[model samples]
Target: MNDLQQQLAAIVGPAHVLTGEAELASYLTDWRGRYRGRALALVKPGSTDEVAAVVRACAAAGVPMVPQGGNTSLCGAATPDQGGRSVLVNLSRLNRIRQIDAANNAITVEAGCLLAQVQEAAAAAGRLFPLALASEGSCQIGGNLSTNAGGVQVLRYGNTRELTLGLEVVLPDGCLWNGLTALRKDNTGYDLKDLFIGAEGTLGIITAAVLKLFPRPRAVVTAWLAVADGAAAIALLGRAQARFDARLTAFELISRQSLDLVLQHIPGSRQPLAAPAPWQVLLELADGGAWADLQADLEDFIGGEMADGRVQDGVLAQNETQARQLWALRENISEAQKIEGLSIKHDISVPVSRIPEFLDLAGTALAAAFPGVRVVAFGHAGDGNLHYNLSKAQRQDNDAFIAATPQANRIVHDLVARLGGSISAEHGIGQLKREELVRYKDPVGLDLMRCIKSSLDPRGLMNPGKIL
Candidate 1:
């Protein structure tokens, strides 16, 4: 081992430092296999002090460092570069739930804690963490915070940024900043925790965090509604929101093509509606009230919508098992799409009112540009975030279609930009969207972000080539 590797081994112990190619292979690539990189060494730090030591060692050697959590990044934020000069500092060993204050509705946890584990912890305390994602089983809280992840629950609880109360980060220079406070009403200056939340590890390494929790819902109602089109879906969403108010926890929109792929690929998956419509909506209402009343209210609302032209057909989940099965259909969209074939994906957002326009304009523009391109649109419609993806029916033609990602992105993202929408809604700009970020980000905002990055990590050794 070289001197630097030896020093890292000394800090975290020899067994925790991995340099073999086979040992480092899994840590090199992203979850979707879109990005693969080489690292000088993979260091597993067990505590904040150990992480600080590892950072110091890398800084002294003038080598870059990639702070990795669960390695489930969609944008390759945690993956190192192809240069093979950087070190991967994995935080899985630091998984720990330090404290949970039921009265304060907060939980303090280390960065390496799996999201599911945190959720279970909150449930054990008779509370809800509110940030729910399909990859919750494997993704870590630090990564969720770093990406400012938004899932189906974002419609009600907000994104990870809003759920975060405080953070503890390791500076690029090896200094640890402990700001893990559970206070909900702190009139502190600048709110330093917000800087590292969505910075995608560019600003610093998030080691631990204090997360906000919510009261556990005593009852939940899940329903699948078939709608005429995006416009009808939005109209129904508005009606549901006005009626249910805060009880509306999730409102996801799924295209017919998206549902078809799920039914074709995902085993045991059945279509909720007897006949498929052009669009489908999965709506959920959670409240502390009685379950029977909640279900009746949802049924009544759906009945009225069906009486109008808003809803074509609808089915309410009768039990928890049925509700989970209904949720499975929505959550399995991405996996089914992957099983079908390769496609270019976009996670963009606009105002809720303009969702119909975005779908229409972007769909028309893409069809004009690439003939026979299947647009798979589905996501949290209540928040106007859509996982808009494109693929050709013929797998043989996908190569050419994939090569035209830039053109497709231009058509879609230009429309999003024109509509005052974000090119990347929940996903962070890692290596995947760096150029697009530069293209769409405002000049003044970009300058300020760069200034903050420079101020925090002047050497640019902390997760280089990410989010900037």
Candidate 2:
């Protein structure tokens, strides 16, 4: 074994150091199964101290370290690059909820804890850890923090970065930064935790965190609304927010093609509206009181929207089961798309007011560029984020379509930029979006990011070939 490999094995026992092809295979491929890489070894560290030691050993030997958590990154953020010189630091063994303070409404947890486990811990204490996602069961909190994940509840609770109170990170040099303070108000210096929150494991390795919690919602109402177009969905959102305000937990927009894919792929999927409109919005509202009256609120708002012809048809959930059924249609989009086959995907975001314009312009531009291409656009519309994807025609095979990704991205991302939107809204700029990020980011922004990365990781050993 090489010097660095020996050191890694010593740091986290030889048994935890996986060099076999089969064991390392899963760590190399991303969630989308798009990019696959090779690594010298996969090192599993079971604690913050162990992580620091492993990182320090790698730094000493000048080996690049790829920090992996849950391996659920859509953008290959948690996957190692093909270079084979680096070692993958798997953090799944560190999963643990260290503490849950009901009084402070906070939870201290290791970075490898699954997001769903954190939610359950909060629920046990009669609080809600609202940073949720479709992959919560497998995605770790560290991955969520790294990507600054935006899920359905982000409209109400905010992204993982906002929900975070503090973090424990292993610096590039192998020194541990104990920033895991549970204090709600820490007016201390640069708020260093914010730097690592969305760094995509490039700046440092996040080992643990202190996450904020909220009072559990006593009532929730989920509704599926059929809208004529993206503009109508935006208008409906505005009208509902005027009445519900903070109670509005989520507002998702699903395109007809996207919904059809769900029905075609997922079992037990049924249409919510009889006459399918061009677009659908999944609206959700939750409150902490028993007298939340979400039904009355939705009925009144839907009544006005229907009268104004903004909404054509709708189905409000009568119970929790019905609510989940509605959500299943929204949550299973990625899975359904996977079943459909390979496609070019974008997680773009614009200002809430300009989403309608973005959708119209991007759709028009893409159609003009690639005729007969199926556009599957859907996602958290309330946050101005959309999972805009384009699938090849049924007759065309995957390879022919895959070759058109660059052209398709140009048509879609250029419009997103023109509309003052982010090329990468929720997904981090992993290996997949590194080139796109360079193209779209302004000079000053890129320079600042470079400065931050150079300052923290002077050796350029942390998660190399990712982000900057």
Candidate 3:
């Protein structure tokens, strides 16, 4: 073993330090198979102190360090570079729920804890940690915080940024910043936690965090409704917000193309409605009231919409089993898409009102550019973020079209920029969107970001080749 490898092995038992190519293969490649890189070694540290020690050693040796958790990044945020000069610091061994203060409505946990684990812990204490995502079962808290991930429940609960209360990070120089406070209101100075929460491990390595929790809803309802198009869905969203307000937990918009892909690729997947529509909405309502009353109220609302022909058709989940089945249809879109084939994907967000315009323009432009291009659009319309993906219908054509990703991205991202939208909503600017970020990011804002990065990591040793 090399000197640094030996030091890493000593810091966290030899069993935790991985050097074999087979042992490091999975950590090197991203889940989407889009990014594969080489690393000096993959080291798993069991505690925050060990992580700090490893970071100090790497910093002293002038080796780049890449902080990785869960390895489920859609944007390759956790993957290393091709240089093979950096050490991959895997934080999975630091999984631990340090504290659960039910009264304080907060929980402190290590970065390696799976998002699902944190959610379960919150539920056990009669609280809700509402950072719901499709990959929550495998994705870890550190990555979620690093990417500021948004999911179906973002309409009501906001993203990871809002759910986070404090952070414990190991800076580039190996100093530990313990801002792990549970307080909600503290305007003492600049919010340091915010800087690390969405920094994508570029400035430092996050070791642990304190996250906020909400009252567990006693009553919950889920439903699937059919809408004519984006405009109709947005109109329905406005009405639903007017009536249900905070009771509405999620409002997802799915294109017929996207739903068809899911049904065709995902086994046992069935249509939520008897009649098919061009667009569909999967929404949920939750409160601490009686379930029967909440269900009845939603039923009345749906009856009124259907009577007016505003909603084409709909089905309300009868029970928890039905609810899970309905949600499965929405959550499995990405998996189904992967099964179909490779796609040029874009995670963009415009103002809630301009989503229809963005969709109409981008769809028309893409169709004009490449006929028979299949566009799979779906996501949390409640937050104006949409997962827009494109590919040709046939495998041969798609294989060729994959090479035109730059052109497809220009069409979609230009529309996003013109509409004052973000090229990356929930997904971080990993290797995938680094170019797009440069093209669209404001010059002044970009300069400030670079300055901050330099200030925190002068040598650029932290997660090199990501973000800025």
Candidate 4:
């Protein structure tokens, strides 16, 4: 371990290598505080070459390496293992915006650059990155690509995999694969970029990427609508899509319980509607047209929905400030839930058409087994992903509720499997869902994944015990 640390320090700098327990504490845990790991040392590489060199040193010493960016992974994908035999490769020093090609509607950036920084860079170039996340200001792009993150705007812009055009990776054996092309369509051979985009850093370490951009929206209308239930929310989504088409940028379903939690826990959060319905949706329409006309069209469409009894009540943001405030209610949900209590969280996705059924069945099953279980469900309805979480009702012991996680997971995941849904939606299978992946993934697909992992990382010294 001493010799390996010296070699890594030589590759980067002595000052960048950290071995102190205090210095490594923050990097050892996941964002949710659910996973705590140990490492031999934390190495901060300054460039792609330095990263490759560090990987080569680790490979030679047979030490596993965990590639980490901002340490903001929800599934513990970037955290090292408890064995303390691995080296944590911190990528924050490699942060850089290499180039911006507005003509090609793309931007190339180093892995350590924060998501908000990328969005601001695109906005400076009069374009939109459109990959919005509550953690954008803190989460790094490498982690985003590694997880293939999906946000509310995925309804229009797609996930991180779709927004990405190219990647520069440091292979497990210290080789650099520079496939950073900004071309829109290249039917050259196999789509190599897709493999690493959502592999959760098990295949290789992502150093940089070429990301797609879109024209800035000239007009945006944000609205909060009250619906009957998840079924009504889906119906409203269909109606909105039929009328607004591609202009429907976001459609988020928030249950009344979710909204109430935000209202109670988040200060200054006011209800968007007068009378509380069983469910609500936060929708947005954006386009390259005049702002006034865009708002008018959205208002007209919403008025018709109200007249048809699809929407009970709604509120259109008067301006951008109001729009941002409305978004705050949706974005602060996770934080609010955190303040409320400990909960079993699931980032699952089902077929868009079966979302209502999934919700109904899962809720019923959970309620029957675990009495007084609070189901705090909300997420991107347009993309069929829901952050379904559970907590005990008031006066119940959270530890007791949490002890039933395995049972809870079986109930929820079995129903998801029956309805053709994913156990891990945008979040990848890190240490958190490794066992679940084994049970849910097809045998053939799992075999192929194992073969690829073995071929690339034959030594198994790259992010060990993750995804695989």
**By TM-score, how accurate is candidate 3?**
0.99
lDDT tens per residue, model 3, 212-315: 99999999999899988899999999999999999999999999999999899999899888878999999999999999999999999999999999999999
For model 2, the superposed segments whose C-alpha errors exceed 4 Å read 395-398
Stretches of model 1 off by over 4 angstroms after superposition: none
Ranking by lDDT: 3, 1, 4, 2
Give the lDDT of residue 315 in candidate 3. Answer: 97
Candidate 2 whole-model C-alpha lDDT, 0 to 1: 0.89
Q: List the candidates' TM-scores in order.
A: 0.99, 0.97, 0.99, 0.98
At residue 187, what lDDT does model 3 achieve? 93
**Considering only N, C-alpha and C atoms within 3 Å, which residue pairs clash in candidate 3?**
none
Candidate 4 lDDT, tens digit per residue, 194-290? Answer: 9899998999999999999999999999999998888999988998999999999999999877888899899999987778878889999999999
2 versus 3: better TM-score goes to: 3
Ranking by TM-score: 3, 1, 4, 2
lDDT tens digits by residue: candidate 2, 164-218: 9989999999899999899888796789998998899999999999999999989
Residue-by-residue lDDT tens digits, candidate 1, 1-468: 399999998999999999999999999999878999999999999999999999988998899999999999989999999999999999999899999999999999999999999999999999999998988999999999999999999999999999999999999999999999888888968899999999888888899999999999999999999998999999999889899999999999999999999999999999898898899999999999999999999999999888986799999999999999998998899899878888999999999999999999999888888999999999999999999999998988988999999999999999999999998998888899999999999999999999999998899999999988
Every candidate's lDDT: 0.93, 0.89, 0.95, 0.93
> How far in Å is the alpha carbon of 286 misplaced in model 3?
0.2
Residues forming the 10-long window of minimal summed lDDT in candidate 2: 392-401
TM-score winner between candidates 2 and 4:
4
